[model samples]
Target: MADAASLPRPRRPVEMSGTNQSKRRTSRSWFSRPWASRPRTGGSWHAVAWIAVAACCLPLAGCKTWKKMTTSEKTLAEERTYGATADQRIDELAANAKKAKASSHADQVEFTQGLVKAMLDEHDPRVRCVILETAAEFETAAATAICKGALEDPDERVRMAGCTAWRKRGGAEAVELLAVRYRADPEIDVRLRALRELGDLGDREAVPVLATALEDSDPAVQYRAVGALKKVSGRDLGDDVNKWREWAADPDGSTAEWTIAEGFRQLF
Candidate 1:
């Protein structure tokens, strides 16, 4: 190390006054003297920014009151915003059905049925499903009529929706109608849906019709029918097993067929 005398001079001491005097010196601003002093807070840019942010947030905090809107007020706001949209109208109907409120002057049950019937005509499959599910809650004459008409809709989703609706509204006539679709619907998916709905209806009267589907050209339709028949009759239909096995081996058979056959095996 260098000798003390040759070492760098000690930094000149910053002789601060007493606390009050030192604070007074630091408090002197840009206009304090003939030669202006630098600002103590670097012009306070950060503080100014924080004050602006706080001012903005004070107004924004008032917006939190929107979350406390009553259900009726929320409904009114939604109606005002989305009134012209068909989707909004249908959603309103669904909400009303769940809340068991009438949406129109028509019979509450019939109004719900008509709304669901219209939804079955919608281009979106999910909308049709919602309509059917909500319609099932009505379970009145008009609700049944709408579901019956939906069975003939060109879209498989609409038809499946009808089937699900019918499942919830089970009666002798509903079972018969579903059985008819199980027998005569040209689309395999619709046929399968009808069979499933029939099984859920639990009417032994559907068993014969479903059993016929076990002979359908489409293995998926056949398997659905077998499963439905098993559920309806509560006894395994033994004669159909070999046919199911043959169907499972078919090169063109669907995975639905094999899976459904396995389900039947487990259930038995």
Candidate 2:
């Protein structure tokens, strides 16, 4: 062998061609990119340090408790918490209501609390409409507030939903609420919803409102009022508007004149 000083070092590897050259260029470009091996200058390293710290912290950031096994605990704690968007919140409330249907009474109360919280926090009219329906799931005072408050809600859609909610929860109170909504609500569709619900309720107490609706300028309102008056009064004197108007004009006096099945009830 030649002397060590006289021996030529092996030449650097020859430049590659075609696919190998392309791959090498790509690899070099990637590794030599701006963020790769970035020089520590001024706040640049501070940013990198924060980025590294963030990367290390990301998995653990959800845990403010810092207690072990609390990730699952925190998840359980937010079971009733509404989601960020209106659609997500609606889905969450719907799921909670479905769960509450089979859950124990206490669990249902908890669901109602979440529901009321969502309702109070919600600003979207569409979400408020959903809240009116969800609130019908429980009879809690908070839930009732959500349902009843919807009748007075600024959104017409929510007020309409409130009418439907009370219709499902039929009673003297439901009749009273529907009657009041029919009279007091300004939106024609909402008023129509109230009138329709009152008709379904079939309570005699709704007669006054239904009769008043008969005179409304909106022909739709007058038509609904006639149908509601028929159901509520338990009289089927045909769909003649004039006859119904006369009876509305003097309900007690016209009762005997328009008597049909009601007379049978009295006879029995």
Candidate 3:
């Protein structure tokens, strides 16, 4: 048995060394192929080209296309482009508002509401006038509030603009606000404007306010109040202040008479 074990040592024959040499040659051959030997140069170039192309296209896509804008966006863009300074911008908005009013363009009017509201704090009465004008175009609650606030502006022109806008966007609340302005506004012109708007509103609640306006110190206010009274009552009393006072003395009777007169006028 000892002799047999000693003989076994000679028979292994270095098979592992030969097998390892064969595997090394196979690996070398695989790496020597043209595709395998070349670094991925083309893929790197393609990636670089893609990056360059994206950089080139970025500027073109930076802003929204004109065709992509909605009606409101387009209008805002055009209006906002008019001026660099606040005053200039406000002037442009005013011009646009006048054009919109002339054309009866509701969309343009609506588009300017935000811009107008933003300028309410401007020190220039002209700018504020433009803001009120633009705001008055919309009959929305926000527009109502904006116009109502303008009534208290220190500038008479701004207060007058507020009255004008209030007339265009009249409601029960607007009627009450206008009546207050007509009675309490320090500027006679503002009061006159408010009185005219109140009459145009034709709210029965305005009857008392109009009657009080009849006694205003300014003859012009009295005259406009008489006209407003006619508008509200649907009767041409021809500036007879005493009769207006008489009618105002009885609110219930005045309202009833106005209602009957309005019914007849509408029927005819």
Clashes of 1: 0
Residue pairs with clashing backbones, model 3: none
Model 2: lDDT equals 0.80
1 against 3, candidate with superior lDDT: 3
Q: Root-mean-square deviation of each candidate, in angstroms?
A: 14.4, 12.7, 17.3
Better of 2 and 3 by lDDT: 2
Please, what are the lDDT tens digits per residue for candidate 2 over residues 139-162? 887788888888888878888999
**Cα lDDT of model 1 by residue, 1-268, tens digit:** 7899998897997766699676777667445744324663655776698999999997777566667788777777877886535677566766677555544435676566567557655776667667667666775666666677778877788787888888888888888888777767778777788889888788867756765676668778767776775576554534475653444344244622444457687889
Q: Candidate 3, 92: how far from true, in Å?
A: 4.3
Sort by TM-score, best first: 2, 3, 1
Candidate 3 per-residue lDDT, tens place, 171-243, comes to 8878888988877877777887888889898888888878787777878988898888788877664456777
* Model 1 root-mean-square deviation: 14.4
**Reference-based TM-score, model 2:** 0.62
Worst 10 residues of 3 by lDDT: 254-263
Error of 2 at 216 (Å): 2.4
Model 1, stretches more than 4 Å misplaced? 1-90, 101-107, 113-123, 237-268
